[model samples]
Target: MTDTTVRSTGRLRGVLDRIAEARRGDSSESLAAVFLLIATLLALLWANSPWGWTYEAFWHTHISFTVGGTGIDLDLQHWVNDGLMALFFFVIGLEVKRELAIGELRDRSQAMVPLTAAIAGLALPAVLFLLLNPSGPEASAWGVVISTDTAFLLGALAVIGPGKAERLRIFLLTLAVADDVGALAVIALVYTDELHWIPLVVAILGLAAVWQLRRLRVWRGGGYLVVSLITWVALHESGVHATLAGVLIALLLPVYPPKRREVEWAAELTKRFRQSPNPEYARTARLGLDRAVSVNERLMRLYQPYTAFIIVPLFALANAGVALTGETLLAAATSPLTWGIVLGLVVGKFLGITGSTALLRRKLPPGLTMSQVAGGAALSGIGFTISLFIVDLALTDDEALADQARIGVLVASVLAALLGAVVFKVAPAPEGPSMELLRPVDPRRDHVRGPVDAPLTIVEYADFECPFCGKATGSMRQVREHFGDRLRYVFRHFPLDEYHPDARQAAEFAEAAAEQGRFWEAHDHLFAHADALDRDGLDAHAAALGLDVERLEEDLRDGDTANRVADDDIDARTSDLPGTPTFFLGVTGQTPTRLEGPHDAATLIAMLERMATAASPEAPRS
Candidate 1:
């Protein structure tokens, strides 16, 4: 194993660190799930009430748009399923693109566990469904069982999962993403029986045009909107589900961590706007800030609310309104179609996800025990939104069969949520997991910058190429100056190499320098020239620090240097850190407490100065 390989192996288990950081404080998932549940209840009530005839009558009402002797027409339910749901899928597509481009799924090796488990989760459900409904019209609705509604899964976890279930959430989020992709593929490939070749070709052409626009750096939303609409229409005209238009177009849109240059430019513009207080400067600053973030994130921010808060609940209202008369319920009780969906979602999902993960438990992040995996697996059985969507597609010829499947869906969702809650309430909590550093700092093994036996110490879990960590340079510089020989500062490698592609290599360079007894020098040099820490740049750093360049290069190749970095990485991840630039302050020979922010220079300096004064020899006793 090379140095890069060591870091890669460490990251393979720690990929959830990035996803957790991305969604540290958000809680809207539960609220959105509430809306979906309410809508489902309302749908049930309306379909079974004295006004039940009104339910069918209202949804069957036709709506049409015609211009230039050509137009589109569909009933109200179709409008919700085909029109509004496309936006929902578009939001999902944006998230998918974000993950594939820069999020946890970017690293194929690191993503292998969840991806494999998700495939099992998807396949086993379909197989179980087919086993029950073999060689029949009901068998075609197998797609109904192959999905987990992400919104409901998240909401259910928050309500009933363990207190500190962040790691579990991250792991399940990755699996859910893969599950969604698999479901979308089934929707595109299996459900679409008829095809219009010419319109399909036109749709492909429209997608190609959108790709070209992306390549040309066209940032205008209007330009993409016009093209996306054209592609959606063509796709709809073709026999392929129009919602797939959102997925294809979103995949073409770019996603990346904000670049340092663009961020600096945005900052400069904002500074100028503050000084000038002019409209022109304000406009420039706004544009600069917009340019700093990627198009993928911007679209997500714009559309995700509509999808989560409105479209999804509306979809539930449209699709979940099954008439549950006594006869319908009695027939469904003995229906193979109903039983297949129930077993496929609840039993198959649990067995598939939990079984696959157990076989690959070594790749799981520490503190993510099998208990939590079991609970999350049970929750993956909530196949509501896409299940109903597929029921409409697959059982369009038989309304009674569709009703049975819908009841099965409703029953499975409730069962899955209850099972998740029960598993979580009964399971033992993680074995006394602690967020404190799992490994203590040692001068011989750690990158220390001052006296080994100093009175005060600060340990930083950092990524070399993280812009936020890079921004902390001023605070660290001030601390160094203030403490001089009194404070010992330690650097531990915690590279989020998915977002910062060059960070792992830069950390390896630091390790190479450690072998040459110049780790601190290499640390400062790498941070100072963070953007240029590629292979040649690291070579330049080794040579400039009076280290043997050939030996440094050889050390990086030998993998021992990377092993040192990976050891710290494993410790950092096991501790469940918030993210890079996390700090711990403590006295020598004692466990450090994490320093919750106001991590700015002036505030930290003042706080530390007061601490120093209180601990002084001449201070008054309290």
Candidate 2:
């Protein structure tokens, strides 16, 4: 390659890497929200521009295909709605599956609060919409008002500064997922047309084939995709919405990790690959790694970004281009359809979610206050993407009604976001210390990075395999640089074993490296190569750090190193650590303030400076 071409390729690779990294963090939701908003604005501008006729003409253009004497025909807009949106729904199905299997929905006791709130949120909005437009074609559009858009809601929460009220964000996330389930149910049950038996039977048979494939442990993506597309086509021919096919396939896919024996076999193969260094062993090791995770998680990691950034944005551009002329705006404002949707989303969601939570307060989780619930409820009103989706389905034959519903959704979402931001801004921070450092720091036993006598001590509970944890490593290093000797940094293990399969062994490897006085080296190396951390990769890291590979392997084989990592995990659980890269900062005896998520370097430094000031002997205790 030429030098100039090489530089251009390098720059392109750099950009792609940055995009991938960003997609792995909390910022991915924000980026998705930005793209959605930009697409919406572009659609509006295009519709209102002098060339607006082209906008309508282009989307109305028909595309048709035929295969084996069967033909399919659809306009550009219908293709976006029925096809690209299926991928969007597929991602939602993956999220719902993950939550049910391991995330917030796993613990029914903890999940009840949001689950109940979501139920109320879904019902009351439809009730309000129905009351306004009872027994009309527009009444069926009630589903548009019932869901909470996860991307827009989360992006709004980020703007409102969740801070100590981080639990509020969690509540909203769970509620939104449940809301999505409800919306999908509505689409399947109410929006579907009369059934066609033959194709429906064929679809059922295809699903049965999928279940058989699962039973046979078929993990190949291509095989599943082909079967799923057949099922989708059958469903479409059966008069059911084709998009539900994605959800059906997703729910049936296995989410459980490989069995213990299989994981052990993979580990053994990885070890052999390390010893032999041949292509055959290498391929076997790679397959072993792939088998260790469920197909659900693998598919999610592969397709989530495509759904979030590409598919949804395309959906918005296709659907949100309603002309905003004075007569159209006036008609929308005066129509009962528009008012019903606005009131249903903005008023009904807030009242239903907050009131239901209040009524069930005695039975729900205790950490959430009424004010926090109110803030969350207000934010839940930002129903944009799925609402527009339902508008397309519910008012398919009436262009005027569809346009009005779209206008109402756009307007209500903006108002709800602003209102929620104000509420969160004015609400009181949670009572008690902002965060408590439940585990005391031990200089002798813990991996320490700075002076022991530093005024501010930061203890972080993190997992090596977590992408957010890897990002926080840079922030922690910046904190050390900004504070120099005045900050003592301690690391602890809190691997999310269900999500990151290789994390536990990686933690053990780090502990083993600590035995040879290279804990930080191993720590940096593990996070820098998070995607490649297997048994052999751990050994390679140890060898590169000048540690005795044999001794490291011996330490890993021993139970003591694993026990040490387990102790950290126990401490984290006891402290109610919510997620990875949780930090606690304070002096030795004082209560340390806690923070979570992948915070930026400046935020970490500012927080530490405040803690340092408060920890000084000259400062008075509260």
Candidate 3:
């Protein structure tokens, strides 16, 4: 390719890679929630438009199928709720299984605080709802008040920036997951119709068939889908909510990683693929890769995006279109059912969650403070998706009650989000620095970019091969240009060996370059040619930077050079560093403000300005 073409292609590829990285993280969740919100607004507008009757007509239109002298029928709304939502529940089940197996719920002690708080949060809402509607049909709809929408809550937290309340976000997520479990239990036990014994028995047998399939190591996607469909249909016929079948099947799936023997066999197969370039070897290698990961993880990767982006939004579009006439508004404003839902979610969640945390303060996790608990509790009241869901299940026969419940949810969610945002804004920064930049810069051992006595210092723990670190290098250069003599920049090594195999050796080489006073030159060269960072590449760069090639090679072999890199690694671990390109800025004796992620130049400069302003003696303390 020509030079211009190659450069353009490289830039395009860089953009695509960044986009892919974003989709893999919390950004995907945020995007899905945004789409869901948009669908909800469209539904509301459509229902209130001049063509309002079309909204009901379209969603209520029946769709039916028949086979072998039997038929099944459902309206468009019911199809979305019963069929598409089953997939959504399946994804939830996968998340729950993953958490219990390896994520937050893996530790009993760590999970206790949120688990207890979730129970309290659920119970208080039901009590409030019951008090408002004591022996009436409305009393049965208490489940609508108990669920906290995970997507909307997480999306709002992301917008709020988890930097100030990282622990608070964790607490909220755990509480929401626990709340989901409780809500699922309520659906299965409280909302079911009359039981059909034969269909229930058939459903149990289908679950056993799923268990047997896993035992036989049946990994084909189609086989599992067919069996799960059978289980779902049987559960539906049994008069239990078919969505619960998703949770049951997910719990039964194998979550264990490949056994040691299987791993060894995969390694052997990979070696054979390398030796012989045959199709069979390649196919076996692919199978080996698949076998190395658990079924739960594989299925989550396959299904999470579909459920989030498509199924959930369709559910919202079908369910969120409640017409708001003048009479209906007046009734909702005065109705006990509406007031019950609104107050139960908004007031009860905050009181219950915060009260429970305070009551158990002595036994709970040390990371959470009272202010954080309060803020998280406020955010927990932003219940949208699942609250609307339970409304459909609980008040299915009473459209007036369902509309009242929907109105209550909409108003409550907005108020809760606003209240939580205000609480977070006014809350004090948590006690002590969460991250400690403890390693002092030694003039003799460290390579410095600016004056040693500069007012502000930025210490970066980075890996040479990390793309985010490469992006951060440009931002650091901009920071130096903006601050000049006021900033002192220090670099530290933190090579992640699992992801970047050559990074540790590269760090040692950079340290060796520091011995010859060309550390900065080597640093720039390594990042500029990040794709080519082997031993020969390092030597070539050192030569180009005017270092004595012989001395450079000798210094690389010296044990002290490797020891310097190891020291930085130890410091990073001690600080509980999250990832590469993590920045810390402050003066001596005071704790530094820790900034995570690959921030842009403007953001870094803004943070420095804030730090400078805060450090000024004239500045007033809040």
Candidate 4:
């Protein structure tokens, strides 16, 4: 019998995996559906409920960040949607890199369905809206139905059962990503009030400076942040939607490395150290090494919390608030724009997506099942967050229209979410899982053995008896291949001596092998047989690697190698390496940049490129 717990976890796992995967593809609409639902609900409730007046009053209250006599003034809502949302766009930018690099968009075959469906999904909705609203005042608000908010959609799906969750999740995500492309187009073409070329130009220059810094591998978060402020201001003043500044700056960021040049430089640097001649040089080198290590430690501490705590949560809190009241509901239903949006998302999304998917599945070779597509299409209507955003933006001049749109989005999103849950529950699982099962990748080993000069470093720390460590090797190998020399892979020992009684000795065996110029070989052997990392197994691995077993045994007994392994663990812990296969890419010599967990090559490449340019001399000068 299928393990029920496994199935449930698999579903949750699929949701996260899809999020990671969809970040690369432009087709993450399912997530949007859920985000829209929550945002719209919050917005509707904030507008109509008892708290509605308070919410509105609160949002309208102005806040400012001032320096000297100058300050930026914005209402609380503006801070959320414009200021905080920039970080959201930054995440979107990161996902765009992943997709274009190695995800679904990377393959022409995989891309065709989403691109075609996205085009149809977008076009069908606008045409449907035009047919419904005609030339009346509501015509211009047609952009509301065209959006797909990934966060809201996925969040809803998380509540549902998990059978065939992976497939449906993938379908909805790619579809939504397609919708984003169209949404961005609408913003650029239809939304702007006037062109402020001079400030816009300044924004571009600021962005260019950021790009230069990224190329130089300047992993200084503050540096790009300062540039982002200027760019947003310039764009805002330029009569472009200031939020577009987020998108624009995100695009200019360098996400890939400078090819083999950096890799070769690192290897050469390492080789030079191995061949150092002068005794005096060693003393000087020690000081330099110490300084470099300290610099890396300090940089890591500074960057993580700022992005995680300051940027992300602020965006969420600000954007998550929307008022709901009885007056708003009446206003929402009466408003043509909001009505159109509600019907379009709730009804139009299901019809357009499901029908189009069915027609396309019959005609196209690369297609998911109709049931899966239908379930996914249902999920696509969970456009609460982005839908609310567009509703606010689309009907800025007409409060009635905006209120109606929020109601429509909220109601439609809920209906869609419920429908998606029922359908996914009944959908049959295919025999073979297509998307690779994600195995955890260890960071400790990758951290220690991984090169200092390497653009991306993956450190794996593991106990030889740990089952998770055994599973991680395949996943990491795939990463190594994808990144090639761009990554400097490392392996370290944290044998969890308490968990597995003999694992400490096994770690010592691997350390001893490193001294004998065969650390990698022994490292692989230990993990390959992690189930049996006892003395017999380690000894066999040593013998297999053609090491002098007698000498290796003697070294292991002395405990010196074990002490060194302990030091490696201490280093990893100090660096905030979260778990096995925790990754840190120095990106450049300037600072420490870390991406925790089992990340794809694309993220690593993007981080490396950003670091390189950010640290360049031309960065600040520009």
| Poorest 10 consecutive residues by lDDT, candidate 4 | 433-442
lDDT of 1 by residue, 1-622 (tens): 3344334333422432333333322558888899999999999999999999999999999999888898889999998898888888888888888777656676676678888889999999999999999978998999999999999999999888886666688789899999999999999989898999999999999999999998998776788899999899889989899989988899899776555355556666766776688999989877876676678777887787778889999999988998989999998999999999999999999999999999999887645789999999999999999999999999999999999999999999999999998988899865654656555677766778889887777888998898888888768988878777778888899998768877987998888788888887888788888887754466567778899876776676554665567656766676777788888777645676677877776766565555556567564322
User: Candidate 2's residue-wise lDDT over 1-622, tens digit each?
Assistant: 3333334333433433343344333667788889989999999999999999999899989998898898779999988888878888887898788778755676677689889999999999989988889978988899999999888888777767455444566678889989999999999999997999999999999999889999998987788999999998898899999999999889888875334345556666766776789999999877776676578777887888888888888888998998999988999989889999989999999999999999887764334567778988998999999999999999989999899999999988988887787877788765543368655677877888999877778888999999999999988888888878878899999999879877987998888888888888889999999996754466567778889876776676444676577668866765667889888878756867687644788887777666656567475322
Q: What is the lDDT of residue 174 in candidate 4?
A: 67
- Give the Cα lDDT of each candidate: 0.82, 0.81, 0.79, 0.60
Report the C-alpha displacement of residue 450, candidate 4, in angstroms: 39
Superposed model 1: Cα runs more than 4 Å off = 1-25, 276-280, 431-622
Count: clashes, candidate 4: 88
Q: Of the pair 1 and 4, which is ahead by lDDT? A: 1
> Residue 324's C-alpha lDDT in candidate 4?
50
Which lDDT tens digits does candidate 4 get at residues 1-622? 1233223223333443344333323353344433444444454456557665686687779998888996678898887777766656555555454445434555556466667777776777677766767776578778877877666666566566354345455556666766776787787688786897898899889888878977776653567778888988887778777777766666655443112223233333333444674656555433333222212222322332343334434443344443455677677667666666666776677788877766667543222467767776777776655566666666678766655665676677777778888887788755543221111233433334444455555545566666777776766676667656666666656656446755766787777787677877877888887765544456567777899876775565443574466555555543434555454445444334455544555665565556656666364211
Residue 230, candidate 1: C-alpha displacement in angstroms? 0.7
What shift in Å separates residue 366 of candidate 1 from its native position after superposition?
1.2
Over 338-412, each residue of candidate 3 has an lDDT whose tens digit, in order, gives 888888898889899999999888765434578778877887897788888889898989999889989988888
All predictions: root-mean-square deviation over Cα?
Answer: 11.3, 11.0, 11.9, 19.2
Candidate no. 4 TM-score: 0.56
Q: Where does candidate 1 have its weakest 10-residue lDDT segment? A: 16-25
Task: Quote the lDDT for 287 in model 4.
Answer: 34
* RMSD in Å for model 1: 11.3
